[model samples]
Target: MTAWLSVIGIGEDGLDGLSSAARTLLGQAELIIGGERHLAMVPDDGRERLCWPRPLKAAIPEILARRGRRVAVLATGDPMCYGVGARLSRVVSADEMTIIPALSAFSLAAARMAWSLPDIETVTLHGRPAEMIIPCLYPGARILALTADGGTPGTVARILCEQGYPDSRMSVVEQMGGPAERRIDGIARDWPDGRAAELNTLAVECIAAPGTVAHPRLPGLPDDVFLHDGQLTKREVRAATLALLAPLPAQRLWDVGAGAGSIAIEWLRSHPNNKAVAIERAPERCALIARNAAALGAPLLEVVEGSAPQALAGLGAPDAVFIGGGIGAEGLVDTCWRALPPGGRLVANVVTVEGEKTVFECHQRLGGSLTRIAVCRGEAVGPYTGWKPLMPVTQWAAVKP
Candidate 1:
């Protein structure tokens, strides 16, 4: 039988916040494991203390391999709530562990601001990048972000400002649930100086202009919203293409040749749980995709700055796939089709004749639906009206056999 591991959640209040049961567990722990802050909480009376290595994932297995040890792992707040508990739980069986959770910083911050947690989106940048929070932002969306450090709030503020949401209200909750608990409220436009804390969580209230483009809930958002280099599929056509791809929740998507990331962004938008790895060769286009994703609340689009076929390796399999660009007469379609699992959908869109022919040939061999989409818009050429024909898009969609 594997020895039990006790994962305990502690707050800045230290032993004061600990329950009698938790304190007893700490006292009896033969091996106490925690971050520096957490280790300081327990009375240092000869219990073997271990600090986690730089990459926590690399350290977990070695620590767990030590058998017959009464190990106590300390985390901040609730162990399962954006804490280390969830990651540890994945590696260890439930039968081999007990979790003692305390008040989470999220709860404390929300309570301090009198905000209900269910109504708000919680993002943690503690050990992650600030960019991860971009996808969760929506007009009127309330956010509780566990900032990486003092620098994160500024980075978040800058990103929000750049995304045309400069007026969004933010409250910095520092040392939450502790004696030095402080809250600083201000608009993102005029972020207060010296208001940031190394250990703080931010409460953001997104405020967007009326009639601003509402966040799309589906993959393949209208193309007009993106600033593309004439290398993007238009809105209606993109939507149709995405439908053919058939994205599923929590599925990974390999968006090869993700020009402007229209297809990839839309894939992620389809389901908050869905993820996409967009491979685009152009640096400018990659940057554009990041900006568009950040602005539209789909910032989780993992942009890979490389061309497809060569870049496909080391990228894991996808449940669905979209090839929006770089589909030539040879190799591209075959590679993507081979990567799909049974029941997986592959949709490729092409505007150029050369690319269209390639798509047609792939459709012929793969046995899927093929269609050409022509989109035109009304423009006032003279006085009354004129119809302008945008270039047609040829699409091929196939399900893996």
Candidate 2:
């Protein structure tokens, strides 16, 4: 058994809360690895101790070298639940490791609140910005968020006020499973963020204030919700593009020429596992992409600043790719077509005549449907309402064979 590694979950109470099996395994550990906080739990164990190195993902090789030795990793709550165990598991062989789980903080928090775990949503603001919680702010929703530090509650509180959830009730539950464990309750508008301790988890009982129109978490989010500089993919067309892209579980997308990052944002909003990378040439647009993604709850969207083809290099092949601009650029479409694997979807939209010609020529050779989307909205013309035609968009979409 010493030849395989054992990753153990220890709580705030440290060794006192561990099971007999976990205690025995930890006792025999020839080498232990954990953060400074978790390391303080065990005293004079008479074993070699190694602090978890910085950039933990990059430290995998050093960890794997200790394999076949009596090695133990101390983790918080459940190691598989957004802990280092999951990170290392991606690089280390599963055959050489065993994971022992403890009760998760979410489980404990839900239990304390008497809220059913399945009925409530759980997210971790751990090492994440509070703006990333926007997608979960709809009325009547309950959320258990793991906070990074004492300041996280304040940040969350401010975000709620801006997002029209000022009346949402909050619970700052501190140091769960420890002697210091306690819950401080208040509304988002009056949250005593500074009063809460560092090691805390926040539970939200969402109740949108009166007349605070909520941004419904759906494919067709209204255009006004995003802070764009007039250059936007119209709401109706954006919805159609997302439907054509067909976001699926665990799929990744490349949003090339991501003017306002609407497509990528919607793709991420579709599912938690869904991922996207926004590539834009203009620095201003890239900035918008980051802010829009964070504000809309997909902060994980990677924004790379550079034109396509050059920027697309070294990027992981995407499950789907959307070209929202620069359709007339030479070799841009060809590179995207070749980069996609079989069954991968590629969709591009254009408005200019030159851009349409490019897409039409590609359709003739590649054989995808060419569609001209023309939308007309009601407008006041002197006396009565009249139909106002907007710029027509030509869209071409195909799957790699």
Question: Which candidate should be chosen as best, given lDDT against the real structure?
Answer: 2
TM for every model, in the order presented, reads 0.89, 0.93
> Which lDDT value does model 1 have at 125?
80
Q: What does candidate 1's lDDT look like per residue over 361-395, in tens digits?
A: 88878889988898888999878888899888888
Clashing pairs in 2: none
Q: Pull out the clashing pairs in model 1.
A: 219-266, 220-266, 223-235
Instruction: Give the poorly placed runs of model 2, Cα more than 4 Å off.
Output: 1-3, 193-195, 381-383
Q: What is the overall TM-score of model 2 with all chains considered together?
A: 0.93
What are the clash counts of all predictions, listed in order?
Answer: 3, 0
- Give the alpha carbon lDDT tens digit for every residue of 80-147 in model 2: 98898898788767877878888888988998888999998888889876766887888998998988
lDDT score at residue 316, model 2, on the 0-100 scale? 85
Q: What is the C-alpha RMSD of each candidate to the true structure, in Å?
A: 2.6, 2.1
Poorest 10 consecutive residues of model 1 by lDDT? 211-220
Shift of residue 130 alpha carbon in model 1, Å:
2.6
